[model samples]
Target: MGAGLARFARNRMALFGAAILLGLLLLVLATPALFPGDPFRLVGPALQPPGGRFLLGTDTLGRDVAAQIAYGARTSLLIGVGATLGAILFGVIVGGLAGYYRGAVEIVLMRVTEFFQTIPAFVLAILIVAILSPSVTSEIIAIAAVSWPGIARLVRGEFAALGGREFILACTGLGASDARIIFRHMLPNCTAPIIAVGSLLIGTAILIEAGLAFLGLGDPNVMSWGLIISAGRAVLRSAWWICTFPGIAILLTVLAINLVGDGLNEALNPRLRER
Candidate 1:
C-alpha cells in the first residue's frame, strides 16, 4: 500500500485528480454549514448574475446557485459511490461463479452478461429509472443495472486467466473448497484491475445520474447538479451561471475520476510498474 501510494504520488496528473476528489469530498462534508438554508427556497431576484449576495448567483426560482451547487455535491457523491458498489458487488459474484466454475456455468452466465452488453447503457438506465420511481435509490439501482455487465466480463476474464496459474492449481490439488479458492485466493489476485475499473465506473455512474437528472427524472425532493442544469435550460442564455457552475462541477469530477483511474491502473498493475 505504501509503495502504491508512492507511485501514485509520482504521477502529476493523477495527483491533481486526487486533489480534486479530496476537495470535492470536503465540499460535500461542509455543505450543510456553508449553505444552511434550503437550497430550493427563493432567496432573491431570479436570473441574478454570479456575484453579490449569492456567489454563484440565483436560479429562476431565486434559489442561491452556490447553495444548490454545494448541496448537489452530496447527491453526486452519494449516487456515484452507491451505484458503483452495487454494480461491482453483483458483478464480482456473477463473474466469479462463471470463471471459477466454467463449462455450463460459464456459458450461461457469460450469455446473460453479453445480453446486457448488447443494449445501449444509457438507454437501458433511462428505461429502468423510468419504469421505477425516480429517486436517489432508483438512480443507483438503474446505473448499477447497466454497469454490471462490463464488470462481470472483466472479472470473468481475470478469473479464467488466474485459474491456470500454479497457485490455483496447487490450491485445488490440496482439495481447497471452491469458496476458499475463490474468495480467499482468486478474488484477492484480481483486485488490482477491479479497483482500476471500479474507479472509472464511479465517474461513469455520475455522468449517467447527471444525464438522468437533466432529463427531469431526478428526485424532486433533492437538488442535484443536473437538476440545476435542467432548471436553467430555459433561461440558459440570460442566467448561464445556474447551469454553468454545475456543468463544470460534473465535468471536473468525471475528469478527475478518469485520471485517478489511470493512476490506479499504473500503481496497481505489476506489468506497468515493471515498465
Candidate 2:
C-alpha cells in the first residue's frame, strides 16, 4: 500500500486532480458557512456578470451562481458517491454469488447483467428517474441501476478466474466454507481492480446526474450545476458566464475524477506499476 501510494503521488496529473478534488471538498464543507440561506433564493440583480457583488455572477432570476455551485457541489458529490457505492455493493453481492456458485447461478445472474448492458445506460437512467420522479434519492437509484452491470461483470470475471487457482482449491480441500473463502480470501484480492473501476464510475455517475439535471429531472427545490445551466441555456449568448462556470465545474470535476481513476488503475495494477 505504501508503494502504491508512492506511485500515485508521482503522477503529476493525478496530483493536480487530487488538488482540484481537495478544493472542491473544501468548498462543499464550507458551503453552509460561505453561502447561508436557500441557494435558489433571488439574491442579486438579474443577468449580473462576474463582479464584486456576485463572485461568479447571477442568473436571469438574480440568483447567485456561486451559491448555486456551492450547493450543487453537495448534490453532485452525493449522487456520484452514493450511486457508485450502491452499484458496487449490489454488483459484488450478485456477481460474487454467481461467480462463486457458478452453474445455474452464473447463468441467471450473467443473463440479467447482460440485459442491463444491452440497453443504453443514459436511456435506462432517464427511464428510471422518470418512473421514480426526480429527486436526489431517485437520481442515485437511477444511476446505480444503470451502472451496476459493469461492476457485476468485473466481479464475476475476477471471481471466475480466482476460482480455478490453487489457493482456492486448497481452501476448499481444507474444509473452508464457501462464504468464508469468498469473503475472507477471494474478495480481498479483487479490491484493487474494484477500486480502480469505482473511481471512474464516480465520474460517470456525476456526468449522468448532471445530464439528468440539465433535462430538468433533478430535485426542483434545490440548486444544482445542471439546473443552473438549464436556466441559462436560453440566454447563453448574452449571459455566457451563467452556464459557462457551471459547465466548467462539471468538466473540471469529471476530468479530475478520471485522472485520479487512471492513476489508481496504474498504481493498483502490478503490470502498470513500473510505468
Candidate 3:
C-alpha cells in the first residue's frame, strides 16, 4: 500500500489535483464556522456591488452573496458525495451479480442498464424528479438512478475481463462460493477502474445537481451554487456579483473534481503507462 502511494505521489498533476479537492472539502466542512453572517440575512442594501463589508456584494434580497457562496459549498458537497456513493453501491452489487453469475441474470441486468443508458441523463433525472417530489432527496435519487448504469457497465466489463483470470479461476476451482469469489477475488482486482469512475462521477453528480437547481427544480431553501446562479440570472445585468461569484464557485469545484478524476484515470490505467 505504501509503495503504491509512493508511485501515486510521483504523478505531480494527481498530487496537485488531490490537494485542490482536499481544500474544497475542508472549505465546505468549515463554512458554517468560518462565515459569520446568515446566508439569508438582509443586513446589506439590495443589489450592492462588490465592495467593503459584503465582499462579493449583495443580492436583490439584500442577502450577502459571499455568505451564500460559502454555504453553497456544503450543498454541492452533499449532493456530489451522496450521489456518487449511491451510484457506486448500486453499480457494484448489480454488476458483481451479473458478471459472476452470467446467463439470465447477466442478460437482464445488462438490458436494464442499456435501457437507462439509452436515455439522456438530464431528461431522465428531470422526468423521475418531476414524477415524485422535487426536493434534495429526489434530486439525489434521480441522479443516482441514472448515474449507476454507466458505473454498472464499467464494473461489468471489468468483472468479465477479470473473471477468467488465473486467480479467479483458481478460487472457483477451490469450491469457493460465488459470493466469496465475486467479492474477495474478482472485486478487489477491479478497484482501479471503479475508483477512477467513482472520482469522475463525483464531478458529474455535482454538475447534474447544479443543472437541476438552475432549472428551478432543486430545493428552494437550499443555498447551492446552482441556486445562487438561478436567483442571480434575473438581475445579472445590474448585479453581476449575483451570478459571477456563484459561477466561479461552480467552475472551480467542477474543475477540481475533473482534475482529480483525470489524474486517477491516468494513474490507474496500465495502457497509459509512461515510457
Candidate 4:
C-alpha cells in the first residue's frame, strides 16, 4: 500500500486530482458542523448578492448560498459514489460471467449488454426516473441501470484478453477450478482497467445526478448543486450567484475526476507494459 501510494504521488496530475477530490470529500463530510442552522434557513433576505453577511450570497428563499453549497457537496458525493458502486458491482459480476463462460451464456449476456448500450444513458435514466418518480433513490437506480453497460463491456474485453494468456492455461493445466481461475487469477489482472474506469465513472455519475436534479428529479429534502442551479435559473439576471457558484462547483469536480482517471490510466499501464 505504501509503494502504491508512492507511485500515485509520483504522478503530479494524479496527485493534484487526488488532492482536489479528497478536499471536496472532506468538505462534504464536514458540512453539517461547518454550517450553523439549517441549509434552508431563511435568515437572510432573498436574492441578496455576495456581501458581508452572506459571502456567496443568499438564494431567493433567503437561504445562505455558501451553506447550501456545503450541504450540496454531501448530496452530490452520495449520489455519485452510490451510483458508481452499484454500476461497478453489477457490471463486474455480469461481465465476469459472460467473459469467463462462452457459448449460449455469453451470447445472452452480451446481447442484453448491447441492448442497454444502444439506448442513450441520459434518455434511459430519464425514462426510469419518470416511471419510478422524481427522487434521489430513483435517480440513483436509474443512473446505475444505465451506467453498467459500458463497464460491463470493458470488463468483458479485459477478461477475454486475460483469458488468452499462457498463465491462465497453466492454471487450467494444474486442474484449478473455473471459479478459482476466474476470481483469483483473471480478476486480479482486470484491476487496472477497473480502477481507471471507476475514476471516470465517478465523474459521469456526478454529472448524471446533477442533470436529474436540474430536471426536478432530485431529492426534495437534500441540498444538491443541481437543485441550487435549478432554483437560480429563474432569477439568473438578478441573482446570478444562485446558479454560478453551483455550476462552477460541478465543473471543477467533473474536471478533477476526469484528470485523475486519465492520469491513473497512463500510470497503471505504462507504455513499457504494452511492449
Candidate 5:
C-alpha cells in the first residue's frame, strides 16, 4: 500500500489530476457558503454573457451559470460516487462467489453477467431510468445495473487466478472457512486492481449520469452539468457560455478521473511498476 502510494505520488500527471479533482471537490463543498444563491431561481436577465456580475454568466432562465455548475458538481459527484459504490458492491459479491466456488456457481453467475454485457450499457441505462422514473436515485440504479458486469468480470478473473495460489491453498489447509479464505486471504491480494478499476468506474458513472441528464432523463430538481448543457443547446449560437462552461467542467473532471485511474493502474500493477 505504501509503495503504491509512493509510486502514485511520483507520477506528475496523477498529481495534476488529483489537484484538479481536489479543487473541484473544494468548489462543490464551498459553493453554498461562498455563493449563497439559488441555482434554479432567476437571479438576473436571461442570456447574459460572462463578465461583471456572473462569473460564468446567466442561463436562458436567468439563473447563475456559475452556481449551476457548482451545484451541478455536487449532483454529478453524488451520483458518480453513489452509483460506483453500488456497482462495486454488487460486482464483488457476484464475482467473488463465482470465482471462489467455480463450477455451477461460476456458470450461472457468468451467464447472468454475460446477459447484461450483451446489452449496450448506455441504452440499457436509458431504458432502466425511463422505466424507474427520471431521478438521481434512478440514475444511480441504472448506472449500477449496467456497470456491474465489467467489474464482475474483473473480480471473477482475479479470484479465479488467486484461488489456485499457494497462499490460498495454505489458508484452505489451515481450516479457514470459505468466506474467510475468499474475503480475508483472497480479496486483499487483488484489492489494488479493484481500487484502480473502481476509480475508473466512478468516471464512467459520472459520464452516464451526464448522458442521461442530457437526454432529459436526469432528476428535474437537481442542477447537473448535463442539464445545463441540455438547457443551453438551443441557444448555443447566442449564449455559448451557458453550455461551454459546464461542458468544460465535465470534460476536465472526467479527464482528471481517468488520469488518476491510469496512474493507479500503473502504480498497483507490479509488472507496470517494474517497467
Candidate 6:
C-alpha cells in the first residue's frame, strides 16, 4: 500500500489532478462560509459579464455564476459519489455471488449483466430518471442502474480468476464458509482492481449526471453545472461566461478524475508497477 501510494505520488499528472480535485473539494466545503449569499437568489442584473462585482458574472436570472458553480459542485460530487457507491454495492454482490458459486448462478448473473450492457448507458439512465420523476435520488439511481453492469463484469472476472487460486482453495480446505472466503479473503485481494475501476466509475457517474441535468432531467431544486449550462444556452451568444465557466468546471473535474483513475490503475497493478 505504501509502495503504491509512493508510485501514485510520483506520477506528475496524477499529482496535479489530485491537487485540482482537492482544491475543488475545499472550495465546495468553504462555499457557505466564504460566499454566504444564496446561490439561487437574484444578486444582480441579468446576463452580466465577468466583472469586478461578480467574479464569474451573473446568469439569465441574475444569480451569481460563481455561487451557482460552488453550489453545483456539491450536487455533482454528491451524485457522482452516491451513484458510484450504489453501483459498486450492486456490482460486488452480484459478481461475488456469481463468481463464488459459478454454475447456473454465474450463467444467470452474467446474462443479466449482459442485458444491461446491451442497452446504451445514457439512454438507459434517461429512461430510469424519467420513470422515477427526475429528482436527485432518481438521478443517482438512474446512473447507478446504468453503470453497475460494467463493474459487475469486472468483479465477476476478478472473482472467477481468483476463485481457482491456491489461496482460495486453501481457505476452502480449512472449512471456511463461502461467505467468509468470499468476503474475508477474495474481496480484499480484489480491492486494488475495484478501487481503480471505482475511481473511473465516479467520473462516468458525474458525466451521466451532467448529461441528465443538461437534458432537463436534473433535480429542480439543485444548482448543477449542467443545469447552469442549460439555463444559459438560450443567451449563450450574448452571455458566454454563464455557460463557459460551468462547462470548464465539468471538463476539468472529469479530466482530473480520469487522470487519478489512470494513476490508480498503474499503481495498483503489480505488473504495471514492476514495468
The global Cα lDDT (0 to 1) of model 5 is: 0.93
Off by over 4 Å in 5: none
lDDT, residue 180, model 2? 96
In angstroms, the error of model 6 at 123 is 0.6
Candidate 6 least-lDDT 10 residues: 266-275
**lDDT of candidate 2 over 1-275, digit per residue (tens):** 88889999999999999999999999999999999999988997899999898999999999999999999999999999999999999999988988899999899999999999999999999999999999999999999999998999999999999999999999999999988999999999999999999999999999999999999999998678888899999999999999999999999999999999999999998768666
TM-score of every model?
0.98, 0.98, 0.95, 0.94, 0.98, 0.98
**What count of clashes does model 5 give?**
0
Q: Number of clashing residue pairs in every model?
A: 0, 0, 0, 0, 0, 0
The lDDT, on a scale of 0 to 1, for candidate 4 is 0.87
Better of 2 and 3 by lDDT: 2
After the best TM-score superposition of candidate 2, give how far the Cα of residue 11 lies from its true spot, in angstroms. Answer: 0.9
List RMSD in Å for every model shown: 0.8, 1.0, 1.6, 1.7, 0.9, 0.8
lDDT of 5 at 216: 98
- What's the lDDT for all of these models? 0.93, 0.94, 0.85, 0.87, 0.93, 0.93
Off by over 4 Å in 6: none
Q: After superposition, which runs of candidate 4 have C-alpha atoms over 4 Å from their true positions?
A: 1-7, 270-275
lDDT of 1 by residue, 1-275 (tens): 68988999999999999999999999989988998888888889988898788898988888899999999999998999999999999999999999989999999999999999999999999999999979999999999999998889989999999999999999999999999999899999989889999999999999999999999898989999999999999998888788899999999999999999999999998889998
What's the TM for model 2? 0.98
Pick by TM-score: 1 or 4, better one: 1
Q: lDDT tens digits, residues 1-275, model 5?
A: 89999999999999999999999999998999978967899999999899999889998889999999999999999999999999999999999999999999999999999999999999999999999999999999999999999889999999999888999999889899998898778888878888899999999999999999999999999999999999999999999998899989989999999999999999998779787
